[model samples]
Target: MYRNLQLLRSIRYSYSPPKASVLLDVSNCIQGLKQKLQELNELKVATARKIADYDPMPKLEVKMQEEGFVIKVLSQRSCQGLLVFILEAFEELGLDVLQARVSCADSFTLEALGNKISIS
Candidate 1:
């Protein structure tokens, strides 16, 4: 009978669940960090998709050089008569285009070098 009691006690002690610690729960912390990281990754992907779907307005840049002016224009979408409008504006400004590079296949891009025309 004493041997049976001893066997029960040993079995109970060996098969018992682990006691909770007073210290930090490292596994829970790691699991929480993993969840947060996954959430951040999902957010990052959503932000990137939003940025890709965004269509920016046309952009223009001009720089004054010693000899002339360098102008660059970009349009994400093709416009029907944007080139003519640009040329007319240059004419109104009394600028003569010395050189130009244009692309209109998918988008619109224009790079031009111009100098002020002498009135004389």
Candidate 2:
């Protein structure tokens, strides 16, 4: 009885090493992350090039009010698609876009109203 019990205690669970599969999975995840980071870097470079074309530069002002918030952006006429950029940035910050108004002439003015959320 003692001999049989000793043999059962020394039994091999599996021939395959568990760490080998885990290491391979981690390596694949790392490769995927690297590809994603490369794409983001390329996007950053493209955005930088587009922004470099502005002449008078871009200005941003934010006013936090009791009701909500108001954001004002001033930029050269050459600067385009700033509204879309502003919307994206606001959404990223978990803000809700209430209304938007734009004025155009010698310079461009973008006024956006938004409400902030309590992120807890």
Task: Name the candidate that leads on TM-score.
Answer: 1
Query: In model 2, which runs have C-alpha deviations exceeding 4 angstroms?
Result: 1-55, 104-106, 118-120
Report the lDDT of model 2 for residue 73.
89
lDDT top scorer: 1
> Against the hidden true structure, what lDDT does model 1 obtain?
0.81
In model 1, residue pairs whose N, Cα or C atoms come closer than 3 Å (at least 3 residues apart or on different chains), thus clashing, are: none
Residue 48 shift from truth in candidate 1, angstroms: 8.6
Which portions of model 1 miss their true places by more than 4 Å?
Answer: 1-53
lDDT of 2 by residue, 62-95 (tens): 9999879999888887346666777788989999
Q: What local lDDT does model 1 show for residue 85?
A: 96
TM-score of each model, paired residue for residue: 0.56, 0.47
lDDT by residue (tens digit), candidate 1, 49-76: 9889767788899999999999999988
lDDT for every model? 0.81, 0.75
